[model samples]
Target: MRTTATSRPTSVHLFCGAGGDSDGFRRAGFDVVLGANHWQKAVDTHAVNFPEAEHLCVDLDHYDMRKLPKARVLVGSPICTEGSPADGIKRPKAAPTPGQLSLLDEGPIADAAWERTRATAYDILRATEVHDFDAVVCENVPRFATAWPLFHWWLQGMAILGYRHQVVSVSAAHIGGENNPHAPQWRDRIFIVFTRQSMRQPDLAVRPPAWCPTCEQDIQAVQSWRNGRTIGKYRQQYDYRCPNGATCGHRIVEPYVRPAASAIDWTDTGIRIGDRPHHGRGPLAASTLRKIRLGLEKHRVPALVAVNHSDPGDGRAVPAHASPLATRTVRIGDGIALPAPFITEHRGGGSTTRAIADPLGAITAGGNHHGLVIPYRKGGPTTTAYPLHTIATRESAGLVLGSDALPEDIALEDCYFRMLSPREHLRGQRFTDDYTVLGNGGEQTMQAGNAVPSNVAQWIASALLEVL
Candidate 1:
C-alpha cells in the first residue's frame, strides 16, 4: 500500500466491487485512499487486494459520502441490475423486463434490493455536492445513459453541481490494443466523465477516429448484407480503413466478429452474392463452394482474412463470420449462426442425460453445473462469460479431457473443455496476478463477472489526469 499526503489528488471509490477500478487507478499513480460497498465479501476482497484503502461495508442507499474523508476525485459503479439490458430492463423508465421479474418473486428481498440499488446513481450527485470533488466518474452499462429519466437526472444533477460532463462509450479491448497482450477481452461500458470548469483539455475517446480503407470496404460489404437498410444510409458509420492495402483487411472485421469456429450456419438456402441476398454473383469457384460447405458442416466460422486471388472480390457478400451488417435485420428472429468451437452445457446432478442451457446466458456467481463443451478437433464458444472454475482443483486448468474418461463429468461428453479459473478471470479483466480475491469460488466469480475491466478504468484514469 502506498501512502500519500493530502496534497496528492486522492480518489474514493463507491460500490468498489473487488477494487478492479481502484487497482487501475493505483496502477496509474492515483492515491486510492478509500472505498465503500454493500457486499461484505466483496469489501473483504477489495481490502485484500488494496490493503491501504479504507474499505467500508455500507449500503449506498443510506450511506453519506460527506462523513468520509474528502478527496479530489470520486469514482463509482452503481448497481446495474435495474439498468442492464442483460437483466431484461430494456428501458430505464419501464417496469422490470420479464427476465427481471424473477427478482420480484422473492417479496421484499428482491423489491427492496431493486429500489435501494436504483438510487445508487443519485449517490454520485450526493458525493459531488457534499465533497466538492474536482471530478466524478460513473461507470455502468451503456443503457445507463438512455434509461429513461436516469440519464436526464444525471445530466440535470451535474448541471446543478456546476460541472460539465461527457459520456463516452469505450471498448476495453480497443483501448488496450496490441500493446497490452493481457487486455484482449471485449468489454464495452459507458463512462460519464465530469470535470470542474477549470481543467483545460480536449475530451478523451478511445474509439478510433478513423479505420483502414479496406475495413471501410468490409463495413460496406457487411452493411449491404442487411436486408433492411443500406450501408450508406446507416447512421453509425465507421471511417477507418485497413492500414495495408486490400491484401490485409483483417483489422477491419477483427473487433466486430468473434473468432472463427470450424462449422457455421447460414440464413438462406440459395447462396446469393453481393450485399443483398437477392443480388446474384454468377457461380462461386468450386474451391470457395467447398470451403463454405465444409465450414457449415464442420461448425467453423468462415474467414474474413485479407483478400486473395482465390477470394471473391471486395463488396461481394460471402458466407463468413456474423458481422454488424448481418446483425441488422427487419425481423427479430432472423439471423445466421456462426461456427462455435464448443457448446455450453449446464451440469445436472442426475446420471445418463442432461440438457444444455442458453449459450449466452448470464454467468451467475457460482460453480453450479454450468460449463462448456469443446468440439473434437475444433474450437469453443466465442463469448467470455464462462469462468474457469468448472473443476474443483487448480490442476484442471487447461486440462481438456473426454467425458467418458470421467463418466460422471456431464459437461464433457462427446466434446472436451475446461473451466476458466478465477485467476484467468482476473487476467481477462486486466488485473495483476498479485491482486487477491478473498472468498469462495462463488464470491470470486461474481466479483470478476461484475467488474468493470481494469484496463478501461486505467484509460479513464489517465484521461481524468489530463483534466485535473
Candidate 2:
C-alpha cells in the first residue's frame, strides 16, 4: 500500500463500477482496501485493475454492511439511474414521507425496484452505522439533489452519527491539468463529504483560465448563483463564464477541459455510408442523413461531425475537431459522419482536427453513442492537414483540399459514418492506457460510460486526504 506524509489511509468503495473512483483514490495515495458492487462484470473489471483489493460482487442492497472491512474513508456512487433525469421517469411531485426511510414501506415512490436502487444512498448510512470511518464521500448526478428532503434526512442521519456533511458541486473538466490527469469529457457531479472532524469545505472552484479559440484570448469563469441556490437545474451549477466580457458566449472557460479530438483514432475511419448495406433499415435514417448534411453545411469542409440519433434538437452536428463531445449515454445516440471517398489504413493514424469548441459532456453507463463524421475525397492519395486526412499507404499521400467542395456539391455518396470505439470512450473518461476493461464492445462501452472520471476522483481524494 502506498503511504502519504501522514500514513497510508485506507478507503472502501461501494457500488464501485469498474473502479474509476478506486483508481483515482489509489492515484491520490490512498490504499483502496476493498471495492464492492452488484454486477459480476463490474466486479471482475475492478478486480483486474485492483488485484490487491478485496472485491465483493453481491447486491449492496441486501448485503450486510457489518461484513464490510473498516477503513479510514468510505466512497460510494450508488445506483443513480432511477434518480437520473435521463431515465425519463417522471419524478414524484410530493416529498418523501418524513420518517419512512425503508424502501419496502415507501410512501412517495411507486416502483419497488427503483426505490431499492435509490435506497442505496441509505447504504452509506448503513455502512457508517456499522463502522465509524474518518470521512465518507458520496458521488451522484446533480439531479440527485432534487430529492432535497430525503437528502436532508440522509444528512440528518449522518449528523446523528456524529459526522458533519457538506455538499459541493464539481465538474471533471474544471479540475485537473498540469501535473494532474484531466478527463476529456465534461461530467458534473455532486460530492457530499461527511467528516467526523470539523474542516472547511474543499476548494472545488474552477482552477484556471482557459484559452478561447473564438475570442483568441484567455478567458476566466463566472459562477452563477441566486439567493444562495444554483442558477439552473441539474448540472448548471458547475458552469461558469468569463468575467472579462468576452463575446465568445458565456461558456465556461475550462483550460483544463480536454477536447474529444484527443480521444479519436483517425485511422479507424469507419465504413462508407453508401457502401454498407442497411439490410431492411432502408438506408440511414432520414434524420441521420439530414444531420450529416447539416454538419457538412455547417463545417463546409472535411470535418468530424457528431450526429445525435436520440433527440433531434439535441442531435445537431458538432465539428468533432472544435467541440468536446456531448455526453455519452448507454443508448447509441451520437454517431460520427465524414464526407466520403476517403481511404483508411489498418494502422492507426492522426487527423487534422482542431481543438473542441465546447466542453466535454458527461459519460453515462449505457454505451458509446458519440459518432464521428469524416469527409471522403474521390481520388489520389490524401494527407493529414487542417481538417481532413486520407489513408496512409506505401504510396505518397497528400492533403485532399476537400473543403473546396460546397455542402450542396457534397452528396450522400460522399461520406462515411461509425460510432466511436470503446477505447476512445475510455480515453475520454481518463482511464490509463494500461487499464484493462474486460467484456465485449457493448459491455466495455457500458463500463466506460458508468465510470467516474479517475482524475476527478483523484482530485476529490486528494482534497479529502488533506482534511482527513
Candidate 3:
C-alpha cells in the first residue's frame, strides 16, 4: 500500500461502471481516488463525471492489485450476468461441495466461461490481500451467494485476513424517505461489507407510511409473506393493511412509493403508433399492439400507466405514478401510457402530462426498449362522447376517458408511440441532471442500467462511516 495521505476518507472502486458507487461515496464524504473497469466506454463515462479520480480501463482479474494505492474503503460490483436470472442460465441450486464440478452439465466451454465470470469475485479477495483497507464493500445480485461455488471459502479468506463481514440484502427503493433522496427504480441487491473490526449492519430498510386509496387513510406497511415465503416483486412485497381488516376487502394497499413520472419529459409527445415501422413492416408487431390494448383496458382514466411488455405475466399494466418502477435490466422492456387529454400545456405554454402511475422497470446495459403510448383523438378534438372500443389501429383510437366511459371506449388509431430516451433512463437511476453521462445512446443506457443507485451507495457508505 502506498503511504500517500489524504484529507478525507478515500475509496477505490472496481468494475466501476458509470461511477455510481463513486458518486455515492462522494456524497457520503469520501474522496474516491480511483475507479477501474474492464469496459473502455464505462471507464470513459466514469472519467467524464469524476475527472478528479484516476481511472483504469483494465480487467481486474488479470491486473496486479499491489500496484494500486491504499485507501480507507475498497468497493466492487463484479459482472453479474452469469448469476443474474435475466441471462437464462441455470444457476446451481447450492454451492457445490469440494471435488464437485460446478456447471459441468452445461459443457466444458460453458463451464469455463462461468468459471471466468465467477473468478471475478476472487479478485476482491486478491485486492484485500494487497491493501490494508479500513473497509471493503462488494455489491451483486443476491443469487451471487449460491451461484459462485467458492463463495463460502471467499468469506473464510476474508476472516483469515482479519476482517469481519456482514452481508445484507436490500432494495434501492427501500433506502430513502423524507430525510433522504429516493431511488425511483426498484432494484434488489446484496451488499457485503468487510471490516477489520466488527460493526452492526446499517439499517437501510425504510417503510414510510402508505396511503390506502380504498380506505382513504394512512396505514402502516408490512412485509407480505405466504407460507413463510416472501411474496411480490422488488419493493412491492411491502404492503399496507387496511385498519378495517377483511371487511374493507382491499388487499392491494401499497406503501409510499416514489413514481417514475417525476423522471419523464412530457414535451416529447412521440410518434403516432400506426406510423411506426417494425421489421420493415408498416406497423408494429401484433404482440406489441395487444400489449397497448391490454394496458388501456386495465387503466381507463386519464392517468399514466406502465405496461411491462416483456413481463412473463402477460404484459401487465400498473399505474405509473402510484408505485416505484421495477428493476432496470440491460434491456428496456417496459412501456408507458399517456392520455392526450392528460398531456396538456402548463401555464408557461410548455407541454406536460399527468404524473406516471408506476415506476420504470429495470434499465439494462444493452439498450432501452421502454416505449411510450399516447392516446389522442382520431380526426381532431371532439366533445362528442363515443362508445368504448378495443384499440385496433392508430386511425381508430381516441383518448381514454374517466370511469364514466371506460378505458376500452378509446380507439387504437388515436394512440401515439415511441421509445424513451437515454436521458430519461438516467433520471430513473437517480442520477442528477448535471451528472455527465458520456457515450453513445446504447452506451449511456448501459452505464445507467449497470450503475448502483447513488442513493443506495450513499446509505451504505454512511453506515460504514459510522463504524469506521
Which model scores highest in lDDT?
2
Better of 1 and 2 by lDDT: 2
| CA RMSD of each candidate after superposition | 14.2, 11.2, 11.9
Q: 1-468 in candidate 1: lDDT tens per residue?
A: 112454456799988877878987876668888878777777788887778888887777688666877777898976475444423455544333221112222222222222333236778888888887888888876656554355676678887887888776654544543333224344556777888777664356444322233433323122111334212111132322334445655343322211111011211112122222234233333333333334234333332222111222321123445332311101112222233333332322222111111112223332322222333322322321132122111112222223232222212222333334456556557676778887655456556766767777877787777656
List, residue by residue over 311-423, the lDDT tens digit for candidate 3: 22211234555542321111123333433222111111222232233445666543454556566664542221121111111122223334442234577656765556778
Model 1 spans with C-alpha error above 4 angstroms: 1-8, 82-119, 177-182, 208-371, 377-412
lDDT of 2 by residue, 1-468 (tens): 233566789999998877888989999989888988766677789999899999997778788898898788899975475444423466653333332112222122222223333236778989998888888888887666654447667778999998987776766655675556567666777777788855655655544444443465555555655446752332343445556564756554433244465566767766677766653223554445555666556554444332221221221235556552322111222334333322111111222222232334566543244556665666411223223222111011222233444234555555766656778778878887799987766667767877888888888888887766
Against the reference, the lDDT scores of all candidates come to 0.48, 0.59, 0.59
Score every model by TM-score: 0.59, 0.72, 0.69
